[model samples]
Target: MDYDVFDLGDVRLQSGITLPDAKLAYKTYGRLNAGKSNAIVYPTWYSGQHYDNEWLIGEGMALDPSTYFIIIPNMLGNGLSSSPSTTPPPHDRARFPHVTMYDNVQMQHRLVTERFGVERLELVTGWSMGAGQTYQWAVSHPDMVRRILPFCGSAKTSLHNIVFLEGVKGALTADAAWDNGWYREQPGVGLRALARVYAGWGFSQQFYRERIYEREPLGYGSLEDFLVGFWEGLFIKRDADNLLAMLWTWQNADVGRTPGFDGVAEALAAIRAPAIVMPAEQDLYFPPEDSEWEVAHMPDAELRVIPGAWGHFAGGGLNPVDTKFIDDALKELLAKDV
Candidate 1:
């Protein structure tokens, strides 16, 4: 609700589908310098909004507002943005067209350039799906960005990632109440099932072995208790159709197919911004090896595995140890000469 909307009428998607009334929801922190060279764009991750992104931002932190003009743009298909749940007829629910991470970065490009008159960016960084957008920005407009830090994500979606996402999509579509995304109400049954699927994959095996779910902030008595009280409760509040749209975008993420690349190697070769590819060691969805492979191909990129048992959720900054690691990495990245 604290964000502003920028309407880009009838935006054309990469698939050649036109999305009418296309808009972007974004929040800005700190004042822009006269030169606007201190700007940083942070795109949201899947099912994440600006609020979730601000946890890692504060005085002297990774995204310190005092020295940087940070812009957090909600990714398309998120409920707060121009998503299936919020868009009007002809493109409502499952009727939304295919959109890629490339499209999302283009919109962010518009928000900063046209709205703020910022031609160059100091940094572009994010986590997970947000990181996907960061990757796209670096490859799509290399000259505009000086640095990029993508955590727990990749420049392209791997075969292993797509298979995991298929399970989630299948679970949601399987419920009778889903009605192919035209449900009269939110599909509670399917959403609950989808939550269960996420619960299984969101954390590491060590997490369960140590019973971390019963720790502070969330003290569920049993596995069922955590599933219903935490997982199910969290996802059922989200729009099912919008979730599907984000999933599709995430599954099909690839910079190789975007304008300039003949192949994945070509895409990696196109990057000019210095990048830090941080992958969580225990993440099954975006394994460190996947990021390692992409880093090997890029001209100016390095791999830094997040050592922890939090899996994909390690980037959330929920645990102190994980938070400190992120802060340290970001501080080091920002201090480097551009």
Candidate 2:
């Protein structure tokens, strides 16, 4: 929960909507070296805040704070940042303007340069929506970023990803309590439904077949108990409007269209940083093949699939095998010369 805010005055988004007081919330770990070249920027995932990324930031980890200065920025609409729940006046709730991955990267660039005097990053890495932002960073400011490690995410939101997001949006909006995203009370029924939908897509079929829900971190007695207790519990603390804002951002995540590139190839080819894309093998939402296709178009990129049966949740390092895969990939990525 330790965080600092960077005020960028009036910030205008890609959608041409302006918020008078725009701020980014972030948390920093370790100390910046005298050389200032040891900085690593790790953005948070969907519905995740600074603390959620702490698992990858401890001692002996790939992003060990002792070896590198790590900055974890909470993406917009993640509740802790300038989100629906925290924004004021006209920009609050449903009125909050649309923010694209481009906007998030641009704002993060400002945060690093203006607040921390970090002109270049040693590494930019993240998972899920955070990984999407990592791709944006490499394309938007290639020279300023040394390397990128995007796990379980694509440079562009695939058609399948858009459809999946639409399902989430539909579930949220279908609740009578949603009330057009400005509900007086939290949309309990809709949130539960949204959680249920995520459960199906977030984990692999093998995970369910083996009844992995009966294990650590999410142990439940029955199938019904797992759905209600685990899935519902995850989304209940979040604001529905905030989740919707993130979902929309996730749906429209496309680097090619963001800055008006001629095509996807042009966007991918623009990146000069060495990128290591680690997609989970069983991740239905962000399949490994999508990353493989995107990486093929990039000037310098490598595809590394996290081998596990946990699907998209593998990027969260829920399983030991996936955690080792992440750690090994990151270590190798950082060791390379850029």
Candidate 3:
């Protein structure tokens, strides 16, 4: 649907930094039941706005407004929310302090508690970086939530992810237009290069294989045209700086290390919510095995491998069928406990 702004007074970031003015853009669907037990959260993935996750949302879907309340909160680094690119000068990336996934959760906490007056959550769910924050919420505020669904996400951002993020930053920093993260008035060509990097890694070889890549027979153009369409149609439409800021935050997403919470696995093991870890069968970024590792340790966690060729992109759904994947899983989770 549509979202407004959430104002959490004098928000403090994980970088030991504070901003007197903090806002998180978000949207809500359905109604919070009398007991407030119907409320579920669907936080956005990297660079994603609340609208991006609406593909799976419909009248009778698992997250059906008829049955439950769904609220999607935009992550901080995303341009739609308070972020490096959106905030004015002196608050831009170069001067902007680091932000951790915990920082994001803290803001979400304010959104749920203050804005919505939600005392307890039926569930906190998300994909990719959104999933990571869902995990963080489970660990940091165990008693506040009833269940969690983390899709194609990891407990911690891997070193490989970090290195990759650094490379994107390097792409922007190296580009003459980036101006060391100080460019504010104009578009950064380096950011476009960063998006190109995403074009390569965001999906899986399996996704490009066994047919979505094929054309003519399917009635589309040649394979080359499809690839070209993917880049020009998707990447070309997104703002480069916004994408880079989102990428930077995602690459470094680690609730434990960033928050100085050293006992990460222990911390995760203590999550009180019944959890469903949905790992993509073909995902390389946040492998299914990692979710299995997490599920094993969590006091109450289950592993649900999504059988799909979408890989890391197997989330919130790019198409209707993709959307159904999320709908069915959430329906099951909502049925089981929440």
Candidate 4:
């Protein structure tokens, strides 16, 4: 209710199924200038809503709402949008049609152009699955987006990454209460199991080695406390079906799969925008090496590895140092002439 919903009205997805009465939830910061060129599109990550993206937007930060109009579009299965929990009848719960990263960006394009009258984007950036959409935007409409900064994410989901997601998905579906995603009650057991699986991959070995969770801000007494309080607590609040829906989107993400491109390199080469690809040094899922390959294919791009042991969460805005590092990068990128 805090965000505005754009009626998509029966959107046909890439899976060849029509989602009846589809809606896209989004929140905006600042005002669109007269020229409409001061816009920045910052899409949501997996299971994240518009508010979850606010950490990057502030008065002095690169995403400063006072300076630029920042748009945070919620992904389809993120609950706020037309997700399984919000949808009704046939397309509800486990029956929701599969949505791809391509499908997500296409709808976002409608919200930006048809709704806001924005033709050219000053920047398109995000983390995790949001980063996947960033790549999609730059490739799908290279002429519209001026610059991009994708952090802790990839242009294409790696084979290893897909395998990792399989484990997460398996854990959730394994619970009896899941009932093929149609359970009347929330699948608490499955969600907790999924959280446990995710805990192993979300951060680096070094993070656990140093027992950083015991420190301030996190302040957990022990490993079990951190796992139960932080990891389990995060996933338990989310709907199991919604998580599964977004997981499908993440697992199948690839710019190379776009209609015109034969492969990832070809799609990346098509992006004409200036890009700064950032990957965490200790990220288990999205390693710096993968980001290096993406930058190599991009026409104009450079890799900036975020040095930290927070792993993928380094870009998740938990650590102030990492957050500042990311903000500084965006500041430098936005200052560029291109």
Candidate 5:
């Protein structure tokens, strides 16, 4: 395996169920300074693994390995971590316990502190559900995280976001091949349907109107080609059960749900770190408006809207321009003394 596993033994989840012999799959970049003060935690996003996060890390980028120690911890149901596909029976497949963003960050805290002997995080950042974990880390252990940069994500899953996820869930479950998640083989039909449902919300209408997919980097001749080649192709490699498991985590994410915080506002108020909340202006689900409210409640945060029609994928690192915008913001945030 390219990554290392931190055996968590039997973990009692927030849902009150015990996950037997739980493990966290992670990969580290660079070295922890002698003071262990240069550590940065960059958790994985929905349907993303450690390697998928590498696009934001390189020799001279804001996440440069040479200047800081970076840790990418896979979310629980992302296949590599104690996911439905990897876990043994009983808690495997359809029986995988519901994992919340709180559960994810808690385990990540264990990995960061117990495994690495790190006391303070220089920065905690991510995109999408990974951003949700970023907020969770800031709220759950505010003293430990010095700074945060959450892009194309939110501190709470909006009602509309939850409904959108329902449509994605329904598409997958509608397939007879799914067999209520007990499929003996991959549920190709459901996976494709899910991808189709996702395609609508993943990007802006302007992106389609402009036919950006036909251009250089994407290079698809037609919409069908883009749908089949890009959308379907992406989901086809992922396990149906694993996708659904992570979907549950995404739909239910809320930093306020953490104990002691009454609601999202209170949780946002509790974050003591400097933050840069970046939302894609054209993102259908995670709009800049939602980010505005989050920034309003934060003690030390500013809203920076990503100006583009790439929608949520604007922060997905496909477009070099958007990537540079995000990277530049991170560079500025890291330069600040917190």
Candidate 6:
């Protein structure tokens, strides 16, 4: 990936907070065709960056840069991008306002269209929260995105997901030393509690049942020790405030929001592009049933359930995700007269 930076200029978040120093860190691959219509946007997931999925970006891969120009934009709240953790003083973690996945996509739209002068995109694709943004892109700018591929994401974050994130936040705040999510001064150690909550729910019982517990043995002689080590490893370097910001964004994801659209399903129905939703059959956060419900409602949509026990992580865990699924769809979409 060719890492680069985009000076996004001032960004007014959905919270009505204006960040004058806002910028988006992104990476691009392949030569954009002279027509600039062969572009694809691949957004990042929660707690993940563009470089995190380098495995799926080689020759003959589904995201082959050889054929298409791919842009991977780091979502807001990711440290590399203009986020709470790394923002300039006065806009730091303790004072940063809330932003949603829809807000991130709108920023990306400016980067792709206003900055790069790209009139339209061949496709927009991502997993998890990034998938939520991809869905938002299709909704807000139907004429811009030619097609969409959302994997392991929901159009709107479910109430259950919101409750789960609240539980994680509660766990962190209940550590007594948390100090109302403003403990960046001492660098709160209570974040470990939050990470523990995440780890337990991130993976599934199948992971334990299948004996894939190299990091933290599922049936250790002492479960607390394993759980502690598990939490320490993941949250050891990440800041608690930054973690909470990303979780909040993930929890409040929706296709439509302020600064543009409203009514997620209505925006979705307005999409002129074909869509593909690859959901995990056993996904705990975004159930296949949800994807099925979505596909049935979308004007032109298809569903491919990844059969795995990886739960919400099935998208990355089941690497490749049948590349032909994307290839066949792309061939069909781009072949039609626009």
Q: Total clashing residue pairs per candidate?
A: 0, 0, 0, 0, 0, 0
Give the worst 10-residue stretch by lDDT in candidate 4. Answer: 210-219
Q: Which candidate is the best by lDDT?
A: 5
Give one digit per residue, the lDDT tens place, for model 5 in 190-225: 999999999999999999999999997789999999
User: Which residue pairs in model 1 clash with each other?
Assistant: none
Select the stronger candidate by lDDT from 2 and 6: 2
Better of 1 and 6 by lDDT: 1
What overall lDDT goes with each candidate model?
Answer: 0.89, 0.90, 0.76, 0.95, 0.95, 0.75
Better of 2 and 5 by TM-score: 5
For candidate 1, the per-residue lDDT at 75 reads 90
Alpha-carbon runs more than 4 Å astray in model 1: none
Name the runs in model 4 displaced over 4 angstroms. Answer: none
Ranking by lDDT: 5, 4, 2, 1, 3, 6
Kindly give the stretch of ten consecutive residues in candidate 1 with the minimal lDDT sum. 316-325
Off-target runs (Cα >4 Å) in candidate 6 are 184-188, 214-232, 258-262, 317-338
Task: Give candidate 5 misplaced runs (Cα > 4 Å).
Answer: none
Distance from true location, Cα of 139 in model 1, Å: 0.5
- The Cα error of candidate 5 at residue 141, in Å, is 0.4
Q: Write the per-residue lDDT of candidate 4 for residues 113-204, one digit (tens) a residue.
A: 99999999999999999899999999999999999999999999999999999999999999999999889999899999999999999999
* lDDT score, candidate 2, position 183: 90
Better of 3 and 5 by lDDT: 5
Give the TM-score of each candidate.
0.97, 0.97, 0.90, 0.99, 0.99, 0.87
Q: What would the per-residue lDDT of candidate 1 be over residues 124-210, giving only the tens digit for each residue?
A: 999999999998998899899999999999889999899999999899899999998899998888999999999988889998888
Better of 1 and 3 by lDDT: 1
